[model samples]
Target: MNKDVLTFGVEEEFFVVDRDGHLSPAGDAVVDAADEEEGELQQELTRSQAESATGICTARDEAERQLTALRTDLAEAAARRGCRLLPSGSAPLAETVLPAITPNPRYERMSEHFGATARTSHTCGCHVHIAVPDRETGIRVIDHVRPFLPALLTVTANSAICDGYDTGYASWRYQQWNRWPSAGAPPLFGSLDHYESIVDAWLRAGAILDRAMVYWDVRLSEKQPTVEFRLGDVAATVGDAVLYGVLIRGLVGTILASEARPPKLSNEVLRAQIWRASREGLSGRCPHFRTGDLAPASEVLDDVVTFAAGALAETGDLDFVRDGCARLAAEGGGADRQRARFEKRRAAEDVVDLLAVRPARD
Candidate 1:
């Protein structure tokens, strides 16, 4: 990422599960290429997975190379230690009962702080970050891009089935996430001061245990100058990750260059849409916040791509976005495939059995 080039890097989370779908702790021993001799790949807030962060990557090839390398290292480490790394949103029903945090001070603090809610099962998500020029632009980009959040959520939809049941949601992770107090959509900020005013107010009010509670579906990354969208359930496949990354580039640039203001979706309305999408996936009906049109998830997503073509081209990803989306159209969404796989075998075990970590091919 550089000041001169508009660029992005990707971060992803996976559920480390045993063959039986039981949650497997990454522990302190899971090795990573970047780790010191004594340390390891960083454990997530939940110890069910270990995260390997890629070095800042500018072009698509470099991002793909580094991500593949990191995932390969992690897969080898997890296998050597007797567990499997699976990219997914929530813990499958078969593994939902296991609960224990790995040994760490920060995890202990989180357990003490979040209490009952912190024990929830795994759900992976991809976080795509473009390097921002400054905090002001970061906030500005997020604010300007809020209208497109639901569409981003739709295109990346992959969790229509959960446990042994059809949760009847497109992305069940959204349903699971909405339970957290600080989660859901962000507030529409008239200015950066208004956004800071709220954060400062929360600190002054002692509302959050720390700044991490700003769990709005999308936010400015606290440690870096970038707008981060937490809306996607980590894609179940690498292709889905690339698709999401492509959409983020198009949507961010589209908003930056357009006259459109972020849609002012009320908390109630926003939650309703999130719940609807989670339950129905692309087949479910959801509101178009910009036009108030209620349509199926598939229809709304098409509109998102069709509307952003100019911006997509301007960002130099027009063909990439078109080809990627066409691929989705031909394949059916991830949810559709998972659900179909279950129907074919008449079992959730079959679907979970298909969940796995993909290696970079030789």
Candidate 2:
């Protein structure tokens, strides 16, 4: 196997809603109904949600095909239970009773340790796993991608409301997930040993019960030879998810080729950048990691494209990535579309309805 191969996959979480489009705690039933060959459809932290992960793929088109099929399978499964699968990041309305946690020992420990953080945390996210041959390369790629996460969040933002009201933030899921003790931007790791040492310390300190709880926005995957990006909200459409996956691959490829030294910035700075992104999405400015200047989100995203040009060309994804981004910008991403629906109809459910349905291609 080529050590530099950028094989990747996407794991998406979705909420199960009833016929009326309200949250339903029927994930287990839906999962049972799903076809086994559609890849891993696992129980999430909440009974209201289920997650599907595609098999490792090398081509953007292959990933898209797998994701579209998996989503269709999930939708069919949910329909069997008389529920709709909603692809947004957070529930539009608050549940009177928090959804039940998956019946697993780890989740039970999380509930006991984290209390409300675990109970009220029903938000979903899209995690991208890109293979790295070794931990050293994984650490390097993670450091390079840290500054770009906020912009990526802007492109993928989908959580436009919470508790039946506008949250005013594009991706409210980020705010919810940030409350986790080990969540948000990770501090730079000098090497794999440094990363493992910190993980060990967190476990020993009771900050997290296990390696799985190291929920940084980006982290070295404990179960695979990959660096996982857990930043973006679960994209509301298959197109957006594919775009994110390609962009991530491009970024990693760029970093590996350049071999640039990681920028030295405080975690405080990165967290603030992430907060700004969660608040503003693409309509606002983004902080430059090295220059200490705020740039328009579009410009920042363009820089990402420029940085990834070589990789995109090598993978024959340049045109696909460029066109997809243009379409996303024209369609205003998921959050923008959600807000537009809400403004037009003055109903939060309308936003959910738009997200639940398959999106028309641009």
Candidate 3:
């Protein structure tokens, strides 16, 4: 992989909702109807969610175009099926019934094995895949990027409300997602062998059904030659999604170019930091993963931008990242926006309406 200009891709999961913002079982229909020329849409684990994967992207503008086009096409297809595309992490309104599992054999097996964990697993997330030449490099990148995962999650936190009530968390989806035994931040690995050993243990212990169930927030992709960062919620807009992809690419590039050892945060501290980030998002303080000092979330975000400065400059993404940070500062992150909308009417549906990504009409 080129350290300066590594190729990356983004996959975003979205909720399929009706006009009233209720979860709809039209995900398969939407995926089937969406135009695949821009990006690929696939069925998620649940019938209420659809996932879109962008083709390999080398430039910021290319990624933005593909993501925007995919969302637009998905929105149009959902409209034809009498549904809307909700880009939030979790369904704001309480489900009258449990979400239906997608009609795939793997999904069926998951439901059979995990029961409630599978039935209630309807959260959406944004995954960024940065190309790596080999698994060793990918493992190194994951290790180096571990400390910053909380900050990245904070910026993209969008699940403030769930089950028609305030969960008092910027990312309720994260809380729900961590119920899976295999989910959450991955352990720092000494080498590729160390990473595989942990996976081997999980398999032997029956903690995960397969390698694909290695649901760590960061991992080497089983199907792609990339380090996948699965830390953030599905962004609330195409711009937010693009910003996340570029930041991950820059961070991976920065890690690949440097030989410095990243901070070794303990598992307890790492879990605490992730919890704090999910609770506060960008509106409150974040614990510095290196020092455990509390700092404003915005300050931590600026620190991340500074940390990736060299790679961002080399890739000509400095301006875009700067502009995105400024926009988030002015308008707030996804969680903040969701809260603001909910406050207007004190209604969960209002939050859903605010997050619905609709297509332009003629």
Winner by TM-score: 3
Clashing pairs for predicted structure model 3, backbone only: none
- Across residues 48-97, which tens digit of lDDT does each residue of candidate 1 receive? 77665555655555666666666666666667667667766766545545
Evaluation by TM-score, superior candidate among 2 and 3: 3
Q: Judged by lDDT against the true structure, how good is candidate 1? A: 0.68
Error of 1 at 249 (Å): 1.5
TM-score of each: 0.88, 0.95, 0.97
lDDT at 40, model 1: 21
The window of 10 residues in a row where model 1 has the poorest summed lDDT is 31-40
Residue 219 alpha-carbon offset, candidate 1, angstroms: 0.4
The residue-by-residue lDDT of candidate 3 on 97-179, one tens digit each, is 99889999999998998999989978999999999999998888888888888888887899998888888999888998999
- The better candidate by TM-score, 1 or 2, is 2
- Model 2 agreement with the true structure over 3-37: per-residue lDDT tens digits: 45689999999998887768898987887778847
Q: Higher lDDT: candidate 1 or 3?
A: 3
